[model samples]
Target: MTASERMKMAAGEWYTCIDDELEALRVTARDAVFEHNSLPPRQRGNIAPALRTLLGAMGEGARIEAPFHCAYGFNLFLGEGVFLNAGCTILDTAPVRIGKGTLLGPNVQIYCAEHHREATGRLAGLEIAKAVTIGDNAWIGGSAVILAGVSIGEGAIVGAGAVVTRDVPANTTVIGNPARAVTPR
Candidate 1:
């Protein structure tokens, strides 16, 4: 199978693919520490380099935290000032795009692949990947799981520990497990 096919196959069984992409991504990400991380500590602490490396993995102007994990580095894209706190993980089998100035708190997970539990296509390993986009200036609180095809609009605030399954409009706050709009203010 080709690389893309391998990624499709690795969706449910995520161990090997995530491991495979990590080394190459780390290599590309290592030197970026000098470019983005080698800044004064007083400004934003050590997160700058991490962001720089992640951006490097995705290409230019894609700032991301170093310690973050993804299924495929190339499938994930980051924007300016995208702060991903410690323990951020992205399953980017499809695509995960985080807009500029978005703040992702600790333990935030973004996933793009959805699997079928029924034993229908077990041999072929077919699964669908839906893109997830977080618009500019959105704040995702700690431990939130953003599922596939969900878009969080600009300036939206997602409550801590919320499991987002759908779209959230701009300038709104969402809470609870399924993540519904709590207020429009």
Candidate 2:
């Protein structure tokens, strides 16, 4: 049997995001996000339940602050002690795995999806995705953008406002638009 669009998407193959099944899933996720973002901080008791329903896997002590946005929350996995600050956005068209103790500063964006380079394909709504992985104890600074297929290694630090297009080595610090490793002090 041929693979479904969702299956193809998860496999990082080209797929159409406008599929009815996928659109339905996005709707469900959007509803959960809306509810989660609407609640006041005083109503903290209600937040966890919504996140549990939305995310694929949410580990113990994982905390995502309000105003989080994602295409499909079900594709997101958060490990123990992960903290996502406010205004975080993840285009989880494919899996986005955040390892234990990883921290994402405010306005951080993780994108697992990409459109076709060709105009014909782009106009046809053809898209592809790649899973993004962040290793344990890593710190992603505020406003950093992690692109598709990038794996951030353990203990790595991505400086503020950096755009990470490549894999980050363990225990290193990277900075700038096309992030480059900083000389260790």
Candidate 3:
């Protein structure tokens, strides 16, 4: 049997992103997100019931501030005590796992989709997804951008405005574009 575009995407295989099925899913997610974002914080609590139902998994005490956005909510998993500040955006075409006690500062962006490099492929809307994992107790500073396939290790600290493109070592601190480990002064 041939795999559907969604299946191919879940398997990290290249697939055309512009598909009816995907569009419908995105629309569903948009509605959920809108509900979550539009409600008062007191009423929304940690997460709106509508948005919570849309997610794959959400541990107790997980909190997402208003203005949170994701490509597909089902691809996101949050562990206990995970806190996402306002304006966080996740292009979760693939799974995005956030471990327990992880804190993401405001405006953090996590991208799981990697568009095809060639112009023709771009025009065709071809892309592949890679899972992004953030280990327990990690702190991602404000405005950080985590690219596709990056694994942020446990207790790691990502400096503000950094662009993380590679795996971060456990308990390390990284800064700057394409994030590099910070050296002790």
Candidate 4:
């Protein structure tokens, strides 16, 4: 089997080769972060190598604050000049790709892993994995919950407390329970 296939097989139940590598990288990255105790400081993402592996371009002037949570980091990709503020959470069961110049407001939860509900009982721990993608220049407002297989198009804004179920188009502002586009800008 291919490396990716092996990783997929071992995502929830067991650990794959990629999973170990990602964990190591997260630990190293977390240790490298400086000035974590200070306030209002220019902060970068406090990545824990033991947590996961991060892919993509996290550019200069980007900041990802503390208490950020995620699954295997290898399935995640962050873009340049992106700011993931405090309390950001990502469950990257599949791949969670974030676009460039995006701003993630505080307490944003991006989850790609989904569970199946059966009549008798719930399926095993994790049912299946899906990918989540947020396009370029997008802004995810605070406390927004992005579910699996959802894509937020480029230049779109997801307002706070929104539960995004479908794909959001580019250059639009979406809010509410199901997250509808409010206006085009």
Candidate 5:
């Protein structure tokens, strides 16, 4: 028997995002996210419980500010001491894993979904996905966008408003669009 679209997606293979099962997962995530975002910020204590139900795996001390958005919360994994500021968005068509002690600034966007280069394929609702991994102790600045299949190494820093299209080396600082590494003086 052929595997379902959801199964292929979970395996990090190319699959159509418009599958009914995937749609149902998105709907479930949307409902959870809506409920999470509705909670008053003053009630800080309530956030974790909601996230625990939404996310696939959340380690101790993981905190995401309200108004977070994701295509499917079940595909996101947060490690211990991870902190995500307000207005974060994750398009987790595939798995998105954040390591311990990572910090994401406000308005950061992480995408694990990609479309085919050919317009015809995209028009047919065909899509591909790659897992995104942010290593331990990394810091992603505000408004940074992490594209599909990129891995930010341990202790790496991504400057504000940068667009990362490639893997970031460990302990390096990357800035600007396409995210080139900063030369040490």
Candidate 6:
């Protein structure tokens, strides 16, 4: 039998995002996100209940500030002491793993889907999923955008407003558009 769209997506193959099953998953994520975002701060401790249930895995002490959003919550995995500040958005079309003690500043965006380059394919909603992994103790600054298939090494620092398009090496500091590694002055 042919693979379903979800299966194709999970396998990192090209698939149409407009499928009924995908829409259902998105609706589920939306509901969970709404619940997480709507609850009072006192009531939503660390990770909100609904969102905690929706995620694939969440380690102890993982905290997400309110107003966080994800396209599909099930593909997100967070390790211990992971802290995400307010207004973070993750397009988790593929697996997104944030390692232990990692911190994401406000408005950090993680995208795991790359849309087709062709205009006709874009019109058809064709896209391929790619996993994003942020290593332990890494710091992603505010307003940074991490593209699909990027693996951020442990202890790396991503400067504010940086657009990360390539893999970052361990303990490296990256800044500016396309995220080139920077040496200390």
What is the descending lDDT order?
A: 6, 3, 2, 5, 4, 1
Measured against the true structure, the TM-scores of the candidates, in listed sequence, are: 0.69, 0.96, 0.98, 0.73, 0.94, 0.99
Overall local distance difference test of candidate 6: 0.97
CA lDDT, candidate 5, residue 26: 88
Best by lDDT: 6
- Stretches off by above 4 angstroms in model 6 are none
Worst-scoring 10-residue span by lDDT in model 6: 176-185
TM-score of 3: 0.98
- Quote the positional error of residue 164 for candidate 1 in Å: 0.5
Supply the global lDDT for candidate 4: 0.71
TM-score of model 2 (CA atoms): 0.96
Pairs of residues at least 3 apart in sequence or in different chains that clash in candidate 5: none
Number of the top-ranking candidate, with TM-score as the measure: 6
RMSD of 2: 1.3
Q: For model 6, what is the alpha-carbon lDDT of residue 108?
A: 100
Tens digits of per-residue lDDT for model 2 on 8-105? Answer: 89888999887899999989888888877888876754245666678999888888889888899999999999999999999999899999999999
Residue 58 displacement in candidate 3 (angstroms): 0.5
| Candidate 3 residue lDDT tens string, 1-185 | 99889999999999999999999999999999999999999999999988899999999999999999999899999999999999999999999999999999999999999999999999999999999999999999999999999999999999999999999999999999989999645
What is candidate 4's lDDT per residue for 123-176, written digit by digit as tens? Answer: 233245678999999999999999988999999999999999999998889999
Give the winner by TM-score: 1 or 5. Answer: 5
| lDDT for model 1 | 0.69
lDDT of 5 by residue, 61-102 (tens): 888888789999888999999999999999998889999999
> Which 10-residue window of candidate 3 scores lowest in summed lDDT?
176-185
Q: Candidate 2, after superposition: displacement of residue 163 in Å?
A: 0.5
Q: Locate the minimum summed-lDDT window of 10 residues in model 2.
A: 42-51
> Lowest-scoring 10 consecutive residues by lDDT in candidate 1?
10-19
RMSD (CA, Å), each prediction: 5.6, 1.3, 0.8, 5.1, 1.4, 0.6
